[model samples]
Target: MLKLVVCVKAVPDPEKADRIKIDPVTKNLIRQDIPMVLNPIDKFALEAALVLKEEKGAHITVISMGPPDAASIVKECMALGADKGILLSDRAFGGADAFATAFTLASGIKKLEEFDVVFCGMASSDGATEWVGPQIANFLDTPVVTMVKAIEENEDLTWTVRADFDNGYRRVKVQLPCVFTVTRDLNTPRTLSFSGIIKARKKQVDILGLEQLGVDPEKVGAKGSPTIVSDMEITSNTRETTMIQGTLEEKADAVLELLKDFGSIG
Candidate 1:
């Protein structure tokens, strides 16, 4: 049977972050009391995996990298039909950007390298950068296709996919053991059935620390990270203030005059 590994993330609820207070010296988000939930996009990723499993007799596994609380999200994935869960947790794994996180995840996935496909959401809600899937693909030397909306055919080692891209959609074929980042429109996430919920409670999750993975601390987390947030500020400049309200003729005339004076319609 083919193994499908779905990568999921536990993200902070945007509203939970509304109560954050930054430290003057550290400038890190005060996440002590902030509540988090499983990221919505990853739900689509898991759903796609489940649909494939139900149709093709595949074994599905879910993995995540975060603190201990992240295990909760993995359990949720199990409740949705994932056969196994793995949590990549360690203090050394903290403060990872998309690249570092992907590297660590790729390393962890390598430990269980029997999977035939890797699945993930296009991006995390917290950091909408959407760089991890490609980064992991680079680390694993596997082909990657992002923002996929449909999976037409998946062979033991090949995939024909339709990705929603700029201007329109694009069709691409990729080899297997590859990474895929999905958009929400890919499928409607099925509700957790009662049987799935019970099975989830009985599923075994393999938790691996940095040491168990046999990797150096300096090579896994913040120390291994290549990117960091230097500055984050909200700017207020883009707005539409010149509202013109009138009939069609008057509005057209006004627009023409304004464009001519502004050197646009001369």
Candidate 2:
């Protein structure tokens, strides 16, 4: 069976985006009261893994790094057809930037001992740096393909895939034990089923912290993060409305003239 590992992230629900706040002291997002859900793009990663499981004999292990409550998202992955789940949770791992987060995730994958394939979303909804997958591959010294849109071939130890680029895509052939950051174009994710949720009850979710990962204390969290946020503020969206009082032809001409002035029309 193919040993597949999928990395997932828990993000604040997009619908409740208005409730998101920033911590003035830490300069980090304050999500204490907001409901958390799976990062939107990660669902595509999970769906890709699930497709492989159906076509090939595969055992899926989903891993995530977040707070204690983050385990709920991992559990949801289990219910979504992953064989097992792993959570990397610790107060020390808080306020991690992209580099630190990738380092921590790579450490967790290294502890897994064996894996044939690893998948991650192109970016996280909250961070959206699109660096974690490639960085994890760098840490593991493995080949990586980012923005994968489709898996064209998956036979034996090698696979061929299509990856998105500027305006088009290119076919890439990579061997197993490689990392892929998938895009939403890959597949449609399946919704959670009650039966699947019941099956997840038996699957175990292993929690690992800094101690379990065995990485240097100063190199795994905010301390290890070199990037700093200088400032953060909520943007206020306001619209300027103008009333046009005229006959139909005059109003139409005015709209066309405005569009031309704004460069909205050629």
Candidate 3:
């Protein structure tokens, strides 16, 4: 049977307006009181894995790296039809930038040693760096095709993938055992079905700490991160605003005047 590994991340739902809250000291994401949800783009990655599973009888495994609470995410993946799910959690793994996260994920993937294909989201909602998947592929010495919108396996086990580029799609063919970061256009991710949700409780999610996976402390966290987020600040709409209560034509004229003042239009 074909074996596939899909990497997913839990992110604070950012769909809410002005919902981002950062930690004062660390300048990092404040998770203490936030409701975390799976990264939006990861739904596409999971759906792609599920499609491949249905078409080829593949064994899909979902893996993530985060805190112990991440166990809940693994069960959610199981509910989505993944055969296995794992959480790579440990204190030493905290504060991991995308590089460190990729390194640790590479270690965990190395341990699995069985996936015929690997999938990842285009990027995390919080970080948006879009670096981990290709970096992990570099570490694993596997070819990576990213921003994939559609994928199919050929008779020779080569994956034909289409990626959105400048104004069109780019077609790529990669041999099996490669990696890809899927785009949101892949498929619509179904929520938990009754039977799947019931079966999820019975499905066992394998949780592994850093030590359990032999992840080197010097190569898997802050110590291994090469780049630091020196600073981040919330965007402020501090510009002055004037209320213009008027009809559609008046509003359009007012908007045109404002644009002229800003040198956007003359």
Candidate 4:
């Protein structure tokens, strides 16, 4: 059976986006009191794995790194048809940038010992850098295909996939033990069901920390992160309504003039 790993993230609820705030000192979003949900695009990645599990008889393990509450998302993945779940939670993992986050995830993935393919979302909803997946591939020394929209062929050790390019799509053939960062266009995710939830109750979610991962303290979180957020601010957008008076010709001219003033037209 093929062994698969799906990486998921617990991001702040998009519905409560207005309530999210950034810390002045840390520059990281203050997640306290805010509800967290699985990253949106990650559902597609998990769906891809689930489809494979159904079609080719594979084992899927879903993993994540976040606070204790993140375990909920991992469990959710199991309810969606994953065989096992793992959560890497620790204080040392806080304030991790894309590179640091990828490093930490790669460390956890390495501990898994064996995997045929690692799937991830193209980007996180909160941090849309689109770097963690490729970075994880780099850390694992595996070839990575990003923005994967479809898996054209999946057989044995070799696979063909269609990925998004600048204007069109490109078909890529990669070997097993590779990483794929999938897009929402890949597949439609299945919803949670009662039977699946009951089955997930029997499956265990193993929570690991820095010690469990055996990663350096200075190399897993903010300390090891190279990128720094120097400044961040929220800007408010306000709109004003202007009424143009006169005939149709006059109104047309006025609109054109306004567009020219705003540099919307030459």
Question: TM-score: which is higher, 3 or 4?
Answer: 4
TM-score for model 3? Answer: 0.88
Q: What lDDT would candidate 3 get against the real structure?
A: 0.86
Best by lDDT: 4
Q: Pick the candidate with the highest TM-score.
A: 4
**Candidate 1 off by > 4 Å:** 15-17, 20-28, 237-266
lDDT of 1 by residue, 148-237 (tens): 999998765678999988979889988887899999879999877888788888887788999887877877777987777777777889
Q: Which parts of model 2 are misplaced by more than 4 Å? A: 235-239, 252-266
- By summed lDDT, the worst window of 10 consecutive residues in model 4 runs over 230-239
lDDT (Cα, 0-100) at 129 in candidate 3:
95
Model 4 alpha-carbon miss at residue 2, Å: 1.0
lDDT of 4: 0.94
Colliding pairs, model 1: none
What lDDT does each candidate get? 0.86, 0.92, 0.86, 0.94
Give TM per candidate: 0.88, 0.91, 0.88, 0.94
Residue range with the least summed lDDT across 10 consecutive positions in model 2: 227-236
lDDT of 2: 0.92
